[model samples]
Target: MAESSTARVIRLRPVDDVAIAAVDVAAGTGVDAGGGVVVARDDVPRGHKIALRALRAGAPVLRYGQVIGFAGRDIAEGEHVHLHNLEYREFRRDYEFGVDARITEVLAEADRDTFAGYVRSDGRVGTRNYLGVLTTVNCSATAAKQIAARLRHSGVLDEFENVDGVVALTHGTGCGMAPDGEGAAVLRRVMRGYLTHPNFAGFVVLGLGCEDNQIAALTRDVHMRPEVPVFTSTIQELGGTRKTVAAGVARLTEMLPIANAARRSRVPASALVLGTNCGGSDSYSGLTANPALGNAVDRLVRQGGTGIVGETPEIYGTEHMLVRRAVSERVGRKLLERIDWWREYTAKNGGSMDNNPSPGNKAGGLTTILEKSLGAVAKGGTTALTDVVEYAEPVTTPGFVFMDTPGYDPVSVTGIVAGGATVVCFTTGRGSAFGCAPVPSIKIATNTPLYQHMTDDMDINAGGIVDGDTTVEQVGERIYRRVLAVASGEPTRSESLDYGEEEFVPWHLGTVM
Candidate 1:
């Protein structure tokens, strides 16, 4: 409601034919139409689009100075521009490598910003020193969680102020499928990621002993040596769930001192690994919060920090935009290759890439996957995309990196965090309640209403941009600072609510049979 004096309709670009409604407009109500006024032809809801001028059938519908869709039928002035009149179309977008890539000015080593973090033996800097309880199969989830519960309920961590908390990461699949198939490979990658995550001071991997996801195999393969602070056992081998839980408790009790021994030290921002994501997005996501997050990404990247973004399907239409920013043609090609993989993956799964833009997205004014994607990638900021990584793969390259994962928020975030994101920033137009353990998630609300209604869940309000109170860059700076603070041990709302233990969802790549 802040962008314009009228506050009723907003035309983002001079060439745009559609203006977004800041509030619900009644049918026949006069709305400011640039230099003049036009009456609404039909009732237009808030955050929805309204045609600024008459449009013929198949005419390109423009928003944000780019074509979002085509008019499905003749559209009159001041009419709603949505699924009723708009249509999605497949079009080829040009991919030019390194065309928009900008090399960041690396801060002088002595001038680099810093955060208080737990510097690990492997040289990774962790924002939180958490002892993790990781499950290798659905059957072991309960036991793993019980172990974490015992630790928490016993007030065992009160003495370990440096140890953030105990988090048990449980998932639905690990068995009941071919052990060497694509599904197993994907599961292994997720397991490896969590086991090797920097946040965990130490981790206990629980298994059923017979599941395809063997903890033994995971450690040996992902390059973890036996002396590492990873403890693994199985329900069957330990006699039963109770015995297994007891064993876990004993091992972790001993590990408490070792894990708690980790202390925070000042580390450069180069030690920072950031994960950027958007969920419950609307038309304003690209216009405000996401771009603001992008600004923050640029700031961090310049400090030699890593910014990881994923949710492959969400990047579908905007792939070209990122391709242009790739540091190398090879890096650009890696992104395209992932896109191709998604296409085939979806087809085999009996779906389409266009099947994205969930019902909530459409209700929030996103029309197609293309439209949603163009908004989603705004979180990446304007930095050279230095790397493209597989789902759950460890990220070695700094700067902005793309990870391949499904568009689902929780699943996507898992891969990002698994890939070594030390902190996370999520933007949402509608409200979302999500958090990542070890890595704190700073939630940004895109509009004033959601910000006001969901104050408890939201940390930053980019709603100021919509209300005309602040610029995106101003809010972006706020986010950048907040991220550093959170990394330095400030608690996020979701973290305060204890919300991350249930969200460890790994991407399942193949069928059960």
Candidate 2:
């Protein structure tokens, strides 16, 4: 049952009915399946699953010792197990709340890791020091972009060595929905989060007249650090687009000196709140990047830092696993409530949770939502699930937590950042290009080919684990160290390419009217 470094197939568990192809396998090729070698009955692409034994139709296919899906037809040994033969089926899950929850061994303060960070007057640590221009509605998006563009390209930031540069946080919706509905409430919460985000030394809120989301109302209850300067205005009040842009530039220009005065100081790693997400995932995701990231998250949690994992729909089939790790039955029920809400939400929209695992995911060897969710949940590590919060809700708990957000990358990460995550760690097998301004994002590749193909975009290659060149703990420790370096001012690949501005999408829910 011992696997060699060059094993052509990987069996994750002793009870698994299938093994993952370590490389593209041609028909007639023999692959090691732990118990015995199985000859391939069909060509299996790398990262795809291969049946270890004959499976009768309607029987469950197991991976990681859990059911991934049901066989639509009889599957012969070594046959490729994918869309053509696998089918999604609903099943019951027992929620044994707190059954697996365990206390984390927090490191002593003197033994904890440290990172150079900008400490705000509110006692929060910031990973980046940028001045942000936030838009109240899509109508003022252009003005916000122009203000940031002018400052970025004008050589104005060169004078302030400590400031990261000005960024425009714009979105597509703000005016078309009811002001008091869930949509507006969500938008207001997101804007307010960005307004006071510790990463921004100062910020300006711009709005266009006649929008349901008024600048005044959005900023009404927002309380910011007194040292952080904030300016709010509208296009009509400032005369026009030209005037608004010019006035915004002038105000930020005045605040630049004050923002630049901030300096990075050594802070305990406990001050870090890590946001974890995965996109463009493949079968190798669970084996390589995702679990490796989870290891790193465990390390962070042990150091007394917080780790947030989201993507609610993507975790549908694996919520029971998390429920067992919940710190309390109340917290576990809260997560179940969100899952129920998503079920109703998707059903109301005439969609199914199986709508996920896009074409890219399928090509990468995922067959059903159940199969995908099993891999997706690996990013949370084995820490106790302390709290579950609504989308864009501030994450106050110190251990591992879950946030309710869609599987869409941008909206999910945006919610995490809004909840006060200072840095983000993203894993991908299909090469998802992403970034979050102010909050630095570290991209980890699930396989070697994708990392080499998109070398400029990927920050770490977790593929070493798949290739037998490294262990999960080694790659995980590397990711954890890279996180500290990035938080201490290292620019990530996405940051160098300026990918954050356009990716700041908030989840738009409810009616447009």
Give per-candidate clash totals. Answer: 3, 0
Question: How many Å off is the CA of 443 in candidate 1?
Answer: 1.0
**What would you estimate as the lDDT of candidate 1?**
0.86
Model 1 agreement with the true structure over 404-472: per-residue lDDT tens digits: 988888999998998889899999998988987867999999999999899999999997776668998
RMSD (Cα, Å) for all candidates, in order, is 1.7, 1.1
Candidate 1 at 408: error in angstroms?
Answer: 0.4
Best prediction by lDDT? 2
C-alpha TM-scores of all predictions: 0.96, 0.99
- Those runs of model 1 whose alpha carbons end farther than 4 Å from true positions after fitting are 1-7, 33-36, 225-228
Against the correct fold, how does model 2 do in TM-score? Answer: 0.99
lDDT of 1 at 228: 48
Residue 81: error of model 1 in Å? 0.8
